[model samples]
Target: MTITIQQQFSINLNALLDEAGVPASGFGRSKHVATSMDVGVATAGKWLSGKQIPEYDRLERMKEWLGCSFDDLLGRTEARGGRIPARAENVLLNMVGTRSATRISICPDEPASIRSDGVYALPIEGDVMSPYVVDGDMVCFMPAMSAHTDGVYVIHVAERYIVRRVNLTTRGTVKLIAENARYEAEEVDLAEEVKRRNGVRIVGVVCARILVNR
Candidate 1:
């Protein structure tokens, strides 16, 4: 069976803490750890319980505090392939041209940085998201079927695919925002949009960007 992220983190963290002279029972002494990371004890507890995974920033703090190396915490090191084109002849096409390949570096043992695994590389098709991303930029993202947090996401609307920053509003609507100020932001009722014509669909959340040809 594939080792789960929770299992991996729990085992590694417990081992690392033990090496650092902290027993399993010490996991609950989250106040000290949280204070070091500048977060709340509750958040630290969540990390210990594997209920929540920290981003790279917090992961760095954990590594430094525990005096553990990345491989020590992750259980392994080295780059792993992410995705490739299905066709054999078009393999080259998948890496360049109007359609290009996205090189991925994945480490499954990690619980932090969804950017670490399950990613997709999509090409930028327009200048709406310019300044941050322009045409020909390859965006690395995690596929998300719905919006739950504020972040950059690939959206499908009017039969066209576009990238935008999606934010949740108190009014129970989502705002599709463009980085280029010239383009105006659009708000939609997700439920209603699903029922209407030429509506909105969230493709994925952008995690990283690989820019090329400016």
Candidate 2:
């Protein structure tokens, strides 16, 4: 049987949260999620029940907590000009007129800096890194650099780029952590030389994220 959007969302939401191991009774789930963004369990319960939709900001936080793609959480939506919609072009242009150049870079000027270099753009596809990085925000990447300074990065694994923080362990294992407390970090066995060989492949260091209040 075909599933309606609400049904699909409800199923996916519950499953994702469960997979993250934040069952309703545990304060760990609620505490971790609340650390990055302000949200309550009652509000989360309402969302999971499909009784209400979270505001854009909260939705972004939940996405990060679930550690999945935006499409994975929100269901698939049509792509906008090859990148998710961060802001209307008109609005960005107007903001650029007033803001400091160092603070924000207009989209039109993006290509000039990104096209030729190993750098590229990866729009954040989900909420796993919300508040700091949200769905639809553009994340810059540099494919040539494999080394990360123990922080968040855009990585291409299995042909898809995912954003997560990098943690180097004393045992020489690498852990990919989500910004949200709800999601557990994933560890991979890789030597420093192998990592430098571009086997895992670092897409780029995330400089900053651009989020619109929508």
Judging by TM-score against the true structure, name the best candidate: 1
Instruction: Please name the candidate that would achieve the greatest lDDT relative to the true structure.
Output: 1
lDDT (Cα, tens digit) per residue for candidate 1, span 1-214? 2444654454455444433433122223366557777999788766654456678887898889888766555552122122211222222222211333355533222123335235566678777875455686566556567888666787767866688878799999999988666799999888888786678877666654553432
Clash number for each model: 2, 7
Off by over 4 Å in 2: 1-118, 191-199
Candidate 1, superposed: residue stretches over 4 Å from native: 1-118
Residue 92 displacement (Å), model 2: 15
lDDT of 2 at 64: 74
For model 1 the local lDDT of residue 156 reads 69
- lDDT score, residue 124, model 1? 84
Residue pairs whose backbone atoms clash in candidate 1: 94-101, 95-101
**Poorest 10 consecutive residues by lDDT, candidate 1:** 76-85
